[model samples]
Target: MMESMVIFHRCRSLAATDAFYIQQLGLTLWHTQPGCHIYDSGYGYLGFVEAADFELPAYSCISFNCTDCAEVDRLYEKFKGMKGITAPRRHPQFAVYSFFIQDPDGYTVEFQKIVKEGEQ
Candidate 1:
């Protein structure tokens, strides 16, 4: 089988960034170097490196899917004291409960849980 990974181009604080994702977001560090690192996201991998000129784009770029609203809620509470977090909201049109969080470098990560039929 073919293999691939997701890598964020640049980062400011490698330790801080790694801690947030690994400790707070539950992603695990899989590899590391002086200015680069990769995370094990269970299903795949995520990586980042130091870059002085790095600037996050203005958009919701990536998302993590949870089993349900309760799971998303649990994560929200755990991360509420952290940096960037948008309160959870439900969208009937999309049948989803979700929120947004920004990394230390300003990159946005979305958390979502799908509402099964009749729940919407």
Candidate 2:
């Protein structure tokens, strides 16, 4: 049985990635440094690392469920200039409002708030 959870992203710049997830997405920071940062995203722990340790995968996106979709967009807009976050919009498949942004390491991070259930 899986007792705990962890998601790690191999990034090119840990500091930038940390800031985007922490500052932009408003995720609580568990640990922070130049090459690594651990964040508590209310659902699980997310770790961002910058090292020649893991092979970079094809462009992947991670969806985070939030309480408020509006706030998600607000924070994303705030960090858009500082962190170079791209504008995010609604996700058609999930019937949820989704904000898409690129992390410092160029990983697509989607902040999604499901508005309704059983959306196609």
Candidate 3:
């Protein structure tokens, strides 16, 4: 079995992206390369590489699973009033309570909690 995983993405400015992931999202810096920085999300690692010509993807989403609905709500409160943040709501079709926010690099970041297990 795989022991761990890391998702890599491109960013224009490491400082800005770093601040968003570190200060805003509260992810801890896990590792660093010459032009890339990786953050530990407590579940997995996310790596951002500096790319001057990076283009934002239309349908790419980075999602985090919370422990429960209240945890999702707590994250919603932290991200509220931020640009591109949506109000948290239940998605019966997906059986989750979730919301989305745009990262500094225009990436879609979702926070969700499973409300019903083995339903969908």
Candidate with best lDDT: 3
Q: What is the lDDT of residue 78 in candidate 3?
A: 82
What clash pairs does model 3 have? none
Model 2 TM-score, all chains together: 0.69
On TM-score, the candidate that comes out on top is: 3
In TM-score terms, candidate 3 sits at: 0.92
Model 1 TM-score, 2 decimals: 0.83
- Each candidate's lDDT (Cα)? 0.81, 0.71, 0.91
Could you tell me every candidate's TM-score relative to the true structure? 0.83, 0.69, 0.92
lDDT of 1 by residue, 1-120 (tens): 878767565788788788778887889899888899889888778888988787776554568889888888888987786567889999657888998888888888888988888863
Better of 1 and 2 by lDDT: 1
Model 1, 62: alpha-carbon shift in Å?
2.6
TM-score preference between candidates 2 and 3, better one = 3
lDDT (Cα, tens digit) per residue for candidate 3, span 4-111: 999999999999998899999999999999999999999999999999899997789999999888888899998899979999999858788899999988999999
Descending-lDDT candidate ranking:
3, 1, 2
Q: Lowest summed lDDT over 10 consecutive residues: which window, candidate 1?
A: 53-62
